[model samples]
Target: MSKITNLLAGLGGAIALNVIHESLKKKSKETPRVDLLGEEALQKTVEYFGGEIEDEKTLYKATLAGDILSNAMYYSMIGNGAPQHLWLRAISYGVAAGVGAITLPEPLGLDPEPVAKTKTSQALTVGYYVAGALVTAGILRAVARKKE
Candidate 1:
């Protein structure tokens, strides 16, 4: 697939993931708090650079943007191989990310509660990534079909 196509699909998936996460977080206590993790990481990153962020809202916004951009690039890798492997690539990327999200925080000095506090949270976290990856794959497939 073309780079532009890959990027557009990746952006769509990333946006969908964020939308789902943001909406569910306000309504469910068990929803994955990936945002919290992101915010913490962002604050520490800035601090590491000798800068401090005093405004909570700004920090949150920056974290959200960072999440979307990073995820977009990650999902864009789904287009790296033959179209026949699209589903496998999507699932592999999504599951890897989901597992990483829940497993990597504590080792990195960030709290894990936001993402892995409970089995439900962990499952939901993984589900969200899978959904995002499927969205990206679906977009690519649709585009390919239309071109044919």
Candidate 2:
């Protein structure tokens, strides 16, 4: 029962994190564009990058790439890919397991010491999360470039 509960909690945490991340990204996309730098400033950037402001397509692609990168960074920091998030989830699971171990009688009379070793589980979860994030970021970047 405790193992099942922990699994459900972990799944819930991951889903919640993903939802929050997607919501933030959507909100960011809806933000009004602020041209802090005037046309002259933009022209300077174009010149520096050895590109001319030719068409709206190119500008749109650049804007999309910037947004994707920003989103990737933000998600990587606050989402499941980070060690802090993993540790937090692990602690949650640990507490749940602890409660079960104490409240429910164990037929096998198993000790909770093994269950308390959450570091390995946390590390594995974090590693997978980071790997998935990197892969998704790469895909987004490639798609953005292709769209350009």
Candidate 3:
């Protein structure tokens, strides 16, 4: 794939993941979803780089930056021809996301420890990650076909 295609796929994947994850979060909580994930990203980013949360806007922007990076990581693999098989690509992407899901949230204070987290939460997070990957892979494939 072309570099532009890769970047676009990455962006699409990022947007898909955010939409899926946040939409689900909205259904489960009364608080703002962006604020939740954004705060987590902000806290982690600031502590790692030495700073403070500042504001909700800052948090959201930080969160978006992180999301872009994460999606880029996933789509980059495909861009480099990691796997042509859609399901395999999805599995790989999902595994990456799952590892992050299980480990990162607690340190960022977004959730309890994995063992302490409810099964529903675990399942939903994982499902969203895999679904997001599938969405990206599917869209990329469709776009590739259209170009042919």
Candidate number achieving the greatest TM-score relative to the actual structure? 1
lDDT of 2: 0.38
| Residues 13-101 of candidate 3: C-alpha lDDT, one tens digit per residue | 77777777666665753322433555565687677888778787867777777876767667645555644576587667776675676
Each prediction's TM-score versus the true structure? 0.97, 0.27, 0.75
Q: Model 2, range 59-129, lDDT digits (tens) per residue?
A: 65564444344334433332234433544544443344324433332343433232223544333333333
- Top-down TM-score ranking: 1, 3, 2
- Considering every candidate listed, which one attains the maximal lDDT? 1
TM-score, candidate 1, is: 0.97
Model 2 weakest lDDT span, ten residues long: 31-40
Model 1 misses residue 137 by how many Å?
A: 0.3
User: What is candidate 2's TM-score against the reference?
Assistant: 0.27
Q: Model 3, stretches more than 4 Å misplaced?
A: 29-38, 104-116
Q: Where does candidate 2 stray beyond 4 Å? A: 1-31, 34-44, 80-148
Model 1 global lDDT (CA atoms, 0 to 1): 0.93
- Residue lDDT tens for model 1, 5-76: 999999989999999899898677788999999999999999999999999999999999999999999998
Task: Give the whole-model CA lDDT for all candidates, comma-separated.
Answer: 0.93, 0.38, 0.65
